[model samples]
Target: MPNPWDLPDELPTDLPVSRCELPDGRVLSAVQEAEAHTLWEEISSAAPYRKAAEGLRPGEAVIDVGAHIGLASLLFGGLAPESRVLAFEPAPKAYTCLEDNLARLLPGATAFRQALGAASGTSELTYRPYVASASTLYDDAEDDARNLEAHLDNIGADERTREVVRRTFNVSQRVTVEVTTLASVMAEHDVDRVGLLKIDVERGELDVLDGIDPACWPRIRRVLLEVHDIDGRLGRVVSRLSGLGFHATVSQWGVYVGGSVHLVLAERD
Candidate 1:
């Protein structure tokens, strides 16, 4: 059998291409090589987000927060062709790539070049070009460096391993991004209910969740979020979601090492 991760021979060279075709046979576009690799990992996962998206119904609404390059949005559109998807990505380069991918694969979905935060305003996003997904509103550069050093010391990590981590987390650029609340955006779009809500913002997961009006919480049927627990917000986020009357589960599956990140999936009881 052919290697599933191999780049397709027939892939269009004129545009940035997805490393692999999605489950529904739609291709994604990647602005960088790192983004393409990440997309392939998600496509190959057996239990991504604990299958939270499995609950989405046709013609329902889906929100893809931190929709870097629009892979998830494309996947959702393919899975639920009738569903209206709103994809939010703030990074300019990634947003441009997202726009291209969505237009090419799922023309009906809306892609927004804005970040979701606790309120409507603007904020700085610390971007790491080496690892685009590591870009975040929380500037954890010092903390990350210190933590990595400590871990290396504990394990007596080789020079190669230490160097890899250092380069992977290096900052490349800082950009100001427009921010809005989930509740506000939904209202502006006249979207009253959502069948699936997926959040993968590096460390702004809670801020995005907090931005959703409490009254509108009931209208969200399911949530899959990547929570950066290294900052110690996991407990608070889980508690907040539980208080909203949802059955919540947190796991390290599908996340990077260090036990600092986790996937939180919640659905109404």
Candidate 2:
């Protein structure tokens, strides 16, 4: 079967604002050309994540950690409209797009313009233009770029090689952003139980998971994370979830020089 994510190739041109309805009826608004591909991938190849949100009951909650521009949040809302969605994203520019998209796509949902980390405080984020999705809280922007280049070189796929050279090889900037913990946010919102907790905080997956209070572990029914083991956190994450009685299912998505990418789905026994 042809991957749905393989859409028609389009020239990268800065669009002030572009709006499109996802196959599921949720709206995605991209503020820059850099965000276009991210939106496409989210809408097109989102079967697994969508499956994770299924079986949700009305009034249940879904938490989107590192919800860059609200892709997963919107997806969750569309998949389970009766369920509430709360999204957390720290990048200012992306937050704006997130807020706008959520308000139009799922008005009942919430958006938090703060990064979720191991503690509630503030941290600096390396903002990369033309590739905002690669922004990370772990400060591995340069290392990530180098690894991506190395992988593209080794893959030897002409189309992917050209895409990488055109996209990931871009400019970056740094800025400080507010940070908070999942436990704290849950308490602030008076949330009792979470049906699904999806995390994609670049290389800071473990930090985000660490912020969850141990006491609240049972409150979370499922956890889906895009894990980057740059600091050797993959094993720790799997072990932690396993200790919490979550049967972990891991899918190795891609490989790079310094580290590999994985998607981990952990559900309570």
Instruction: Name the top lDDT candidate.
Output: 2
After superposition, which runs of candidate 1 have C-alpha atoms over 4 Å from their true positions? 1-27, 43-50, 142-165
Model 2 agreement with the true structure over 5-76: per-residue lDDT tens digits? 353344343325566565555557765544565456654465568668878888878999888778788768
**Each candidate: what lDDT?**
0.76, 0.77
- The C-alpha TM-scores of every prediction are 0.82, 0.83
Q: How many clashes in each structure?
A: 0, 0
Model 1 scores a TM of 0.82
Model 1 per-residue lDDT tens digits across residues 1-269? 65243534333323343344555565555666655665556644636542766757776789999988877776667667888899999988778878888888887888999999899999998866555666788777665565557656656778766766565556367899999999998899988789889998977887898899977888899898888776568898889889888888887643345646677888898
Q: Lowest summed-lDDT stretch of 10 residues in model 1?
A: 7-16
Task: Name the lDDT value of residue 87 in candidate 1.
Answer: 96
